[model samples]
Target chain A: MKQFFIKNRISLSVLIAFLIFTGISFFADYQPGKAISKEYFFQFFKEMIFFLPIMFVLIGLGDVWINRDKVEKHIGKDSGLKGIILVMLLSMAQVGPLYGAFPVTYLLWKKGASVRNIFIYIGAFCTIKIPMLTFEIGFLGWKFSLLRTLVSIPAIIIIGIVMEKMVGKKDFTIKQP
Target chain B: MKLLIAFSVIAIVISFIADKRKTFSGIKSGMVMFFKLLPVIISVLIVVSIVLFLIPQEMIIKYLGEESGLTGYIFAAITGSVALIPGFIAYPMAGMLVKSGVGYSVIAVFITTLMMVGIFTLPIEIRFFGRKVSLLRNLFFFIAAILIGLFISLFYNL
Candidate 1:
């Protein structure tokens, strides 16, 4: 039972937090803050509910079907510039939040994708996803959108390369679902 | 977004029909991951809510708009990293800020870090990439965001 509590402490803490917050809100006449926080929480959750499940399912399918050799050849150490471009393009095209991409990234890791490519995939995923870019362009203007993109490409790649240099040699523990 | 969800459903259906065993295994794995991720997601969402209520977007413009200097840019970047505001609302708020005379570079800094850095999502990121990689990635993005803002200012001026 103690081990169970330890394992589930994060969840239990959340429950505790929820009760305390509710008590404060109720006793202190803090209804507006509670209301606002609840609204924001649900909005975030709405995105996760709609998007994350599909991402996980798709990643699972990819895991089951995708061959390790193929992923390595395409995005592994020897994959080089071609690998970088592939990862970048794939990330750009995907439709989901950054957190949603984490499972896909872990799948890539399990399939022998290079550290550089994995980093590039994440960088591009957050930076260049097309729907958000269009929204960015609409609000910020084409020049702002275009210039940021041009500048970010190199920065993303550099981050990837530098990260590869840092933890590339470390053995990764493959945590199972 | 609705279309994306619909497409996912169709693909799931196709996969399920093609091979029940593979589909079940895929879904089971997905469910396992879903449960694993839920706690982290809830924690962040709750915190993001509290921050959103506390900060109140108006204070953002009031602070940065008045300064219009290095400090403002720094504040913008810091805010971007900390706040979990989505792009849709952020972009429109940014458009309003531009109208209200916040400089291009400051907005650029905010947007760059806003999209890239995720202090709110750090737990989930750590869960996936571990502590070392997650911190390194956020640090790299934070630095890159500031530089990108500077670059935009230079180019637009030139």
Candidate 2:
């Protein structure tokens, strides 16, 4: 029990902090505080409900199905432009928040994806998501959306290269918990 | 959401067909990963809620309006970095800001940083990528957002 608690300490503290804030809000402003907290909590909870399970299942499936040797053969350190483009397309097609990319990227790293490819994947995931781009075009107009997309492609590549150089292959190993 | 559901269903079918035992083990590991991530998720949600409550839409519109200049850019970048609003909501809000006379540059900075540089998500990031890489990624994105904003300003003559 103690060991479990220790492992979960951060979560517990955050829960406590949330309760304390909610309590304070209730005491200080009563109706609005309760209403605000409830509204926000439920909104996020709904998103979690919809997305989290799918993300986990997909990660699980990827883990089980993907072969490390095959992955490494295609996208290893010397894989170059082909590997980078493949990773970019994969990330662009991804369907969740940026946080959802973490485990997937970790799996890729473990499977021996180049550090540059991993970083590029992450960078593309953050901005070039297909659904998000459609929404962006709807709201901001196609010109703005297209311009940003065009600019971001090269930007992501440059950032990936810079990050690989800075972090080096030695630091690319996934850290064990 | 429909896409996710469809994908999940397909994945389930594929997993079961390919190898039942490995699929179960995969799910078990995925559950472990989920439990490990739960705390971070809950904490981020709570923090995001509090932030949304504190910074109303009117405030964002007022501060990011055309006359706000460099201060507007900085403010937008910071708020966008910290805010956890999803892209669907964020894009519409940026649209409203644009209609309200907020500069394209400001909106660019806001949207870029909102997506790229996640301050609140840093803890989870550190957990996955380690402190150095997480920090560096955020830092690099922050700089990229500023440059992107500048590029938009020059391109559109804003």
Candidate 3:
């Protein structure tokens, strides 16, 4: 129990802070603050509950089914443009929150994906999700969507290259678990 | 949600058929990863909720609207970085802002930073990638977002 609390100290502290805020709001009769916080909490909670399980299961499946050599051969140091494109497509095809991308990126790193490719993947995952793009076009117009997409793709690639240089080649290797 | 259900079902079926032992072990490891990640996730969500509670919608619209000038662009970028609204909701909000006469550049900056920087998710990012890399990535993205906003504003006359 003590170990668990230690491990989750940050979460525990945040939860405590939230509870204190709620108490203060109730006592002070700040109904709007109280109501808004509660509403936001439940909304985020629902999203977490819905997505986290699926994300974990998919990560597990990838970990088991995909081997290091296969990943390295495809997206590793020597994989080059093909590997970058592959990562971009894979990320763009994904349908979930950005937080869900982190675990999968962790798995990819462990499997020996290059730092450049991983950064590209993260950028693409953030901006170019297919389902979201559909909504973007619908709401923001085709011109806006197309222009953003055009600019963002090259921007993401440039960021990836710059990050690779900044972080250096030595930091690319995964530390042993 | 539909996508989540579909993917989960597909993963379960594939895992069961491919190799039972591997599937079980994979799931076990995945759960371990999930638990390890839980603290950061919970903290980030709570922080985001508090931020959302404090920043009213009217304030956002007013500050990010057309007449607010350069300060509006900066405000949009900063707020977008901190706020954790999903893309689906952000689009409609952006549309409303546009309809309400907010500058396209401001909206562009807001959307770009919202996707790229993720101030609320910084802890989780730092946990995974270390402080230097995480901070640099966000810093770089912030600059890129501002540049993108400027380009959009210039090209489209917004």
Model 2: CA > 4 A from native: A1-4, A20-29
All candidates in order of lDDT, best leading: 1, 2, 3
Instruction: Summarize candidate 1's per-residue lDDT along A21-44 as a digit string, tens digits.
Output: 867876798977567546776688
DockQ (model 1, Cα): 0.62
Task: Tell me the lDDT of model 2 at B103.
Answer: 80
lDDT of 2: 0.83
lDDT of 2 by residue, A1-177 (tens): 586578668867987987887899788887657865788776887888678867877777788889988888778788888888899898888876777788888888878898898889988998898988988999999999888888888889999999999996674665422
lDDT of 1 by residue, B1-158 (tens): 87777877897888888898998898889877887777667777777887888788899878878876788878999999998888878999999999998888889889888888999898888887878888989999999889888988999789
Off by over 4 Å in 1: A1-5, A23-29, A173-177
Candidate 1 chain A: worst-modelled 10 consecutive residues by lDDT: A168-177
The per-prediction tally of clashing pairs is: 0, 0, 0
How accurate locally is residue A33 in candidate 2, as Cα lDDT from 0 to 100?
70
Residue B65 miss distance in model 1 (angstroms) = 1.3
lDDT by residue for model 3 (A48-139), tens: 87788678877877888888999999998899899989999999888867778877788899898988888899889887878888988888
- Candidate 3 - CAPRI tier? medium
Candidate number of the best DockQ? 2
